[model samples]
Target: MHGLFVSDLHLLSPRSACPHIETELADYAGAHKCIVLGGDIFDFRWSDRGGHDQTLEATSRWLQDLQLATENTDIIYLPGNHDCHPDFLEQLEKLSQQSKNFSWQPHHLQLGNNLFFHGDILDAGNSLEDLQRYRRQFHHVKPQSQWAHRSYDTAVGLRVHKLVPRILHQPMRTCQRLQNAIDRLNLDDAKAVRNVFFGHTHVPIEGLKLNGRSFYNPGAGMKHMQLQPHEFTFERAIPASEIPLASDTSTKPPSK
Candidate 1:
């Protein structure tokens, strides 16, 4: 099925979220044949959505509504670092088992020639084995102090969140690191894969070719992050020459 990929919503408690995004996403789901939730759809560490159980409950209800609203669409969820809590994983697993349209994968998902992941594997010193191990440990980590979220929110408001990454050239560095990581892993489909789509850097990119693969990231749904959903038809393979170079297009700025 043709699909749209979105990530890094970093959804907090309903009281703090942007309700319009929920409506927008559901509308996209209805229009697309599939929706791939790339990762970090929920921010457990920053969620004031009550406690862990409450947050999961809210998440479950939200998913149920989305599913009901878009029964013909497929939902593919790849867990990101933020929402990999053990109990949350259990909930997703149960839902996947019970529902025909919903599915979840812990690490990476391959659909057609495109590889989808949360992009955590590109971290500075992490090996392939570290992926699941890190996620398991993340479950036990407590919520961040409210002050920390407040400070981050302030920075996001000031658009410093976008500025720092631009200054450091994080997107280019991330692309290089991702290429290295891919070579190191030597994925079974490495030779066949032509495109890699990921989220985690919170920086949106399109058609950025490095090391022979076109990379796409939809950025984040958090305020001022310029959230965008990418559409991909899982039919013909995208030729390298068909994709434009990143230098040919201006990167979308985070919304004010």
Candidate 2:
């Protein structure tokens, strides 16, 4: 069946251009049965800022509209660490109350023979050492004070917008962890899961195969000039002729 997949919309009032995405989604949902939102739908840092309540209310209303627009389609949300706060439960409840087609799910989900997660929970894998070094180079700026927060936000925005794309594309440890996860999944013969989907790396990836299963990371919709804004859509039903006959049976390496 036809389905839409997206993540990391990071919608906030000052910078949110989500209407275009939402409009496109509505058009797709009219003909699709399922819509999967991978993670980080809201930039929690921005949403926690002043006037955020108004933004939240507007977002809620937009979601309701989406529910109405999709009619019978299933809308599944997988919260990322950014939006996985305890209070988000209440917000999700409100959305559910507002629309029958909307629903929220845990970090991991099973769809037919596929598994999905935000991918952050997989740990940084062997990259912890590198990340630690990078973290040290960039001093920890507290979010406590408004000035500090602004400075930190600006710095982060600059890094994501100006630095990441050219210098840091993919981390070795992250790729390792992903491979580890896929390996672990293959041990479960009963599950018969042959595909995995995730977000949080904010990198658009598709058609990659690890072990025997197809791997997909739809990337993020959040725009940072230095980083690419990636999105993807997939179909669940594949023709038998398209299925690979020989599959990799080797175990994935262990995560550090």
Candidate 3:
């Protein structure tokens, strides 16, 4: 399948948006292939504070155009932490119910020789159900109080961001750290999967061989990577190049 892989767009509205990415999505949608909304496509917490549907209508129109562009393209929506909201899930469900081109899978997806996930499966060990349950269990953060969480997370995220090595920096590990604490789980079974591609932690690695398998990530807030025709070539929108070991957090090229 011709696939367009992207993650962590963290799409917001008016004040914050990724128009180029959205445009690319439209172009790829016309190809009648596949688009993987890896994770963090929506930030529900932000929606709680900033309000929802600010950009959703525009986004829906884009998706509509995409579906109209091609008769066979499949747009897969995979949930992330921010996506684990009742209303958002409901929206996706309704859209999927309306057409075959749209689909919502709670967890990871396996396509042909490649495995795709938001990466929480390996890093957090939790499933979509787990995330939703945790959200439900938590005392709801009032709109007025939401800023506290964002501010705290931002302070921590910035600190961690500065500490991460340059090569592994785009994804900023802070999100995954909080997610792991919330899920309290981990899965070491990723090694069994071949050609695994994921988007959590936002760091993108391409053709980075490990344990006889290949891994690729498009990174957070970066361009989508395309897999088509055959040979896989990554056009990184960020500088997540496989670098010489710089820190425990940074990735390394396969040893010779």
lDDT by candidate, in order shown: 0.71, 0.55, 0.51
TM per candidate comes to 0.82, 0.67, 0.62
Which candidate, 1 or 3, would have the higher lDDT against the true structure?
1
Model 1 segments more than 4 A misplaced: 13-18, 30-32, 140-143, 167-169, 184-186, 236-256
* Preferred candidate (TM-score higher): 1 or 3: 1
Which residue pairs clash in candidate 1?
A: none
User: Which tens-of-lDDT digit does each residue in 116-191 have in candidate 2?
Assistant: 6667556433342332232232121122356655765676667554356324446444555676665544333425
Better of 2 and 3 by TM-score: 2
What is the number of backbone collisions in each predicted candidate, taken in the order shown?
0, 1, 2
When superposed on Cα atoms, how far off is each prediction in RMSD? 9.2, 9.2, 12.0
Question: Candidate 1 on 102-180: residue-level lDDT in tens?
Answer: 7776666666778888898765355656776666555634556778768877887798977876665477788888877
The digit string of per-residue lDDT tens for model 3 on 20-60 reads: 76667666654336677876775544443344454455446
Highest-TM-score candidate = 1
Error of 1 at 92 (Å): 0.8
Model 2 earns a TM-score of: 0.67
> In model 3, which residue pairs have backbone atoms overlapping below 3 Å?
124-185, 171-202
TM-score computed on alpha carbons, candidate 3: 0.62
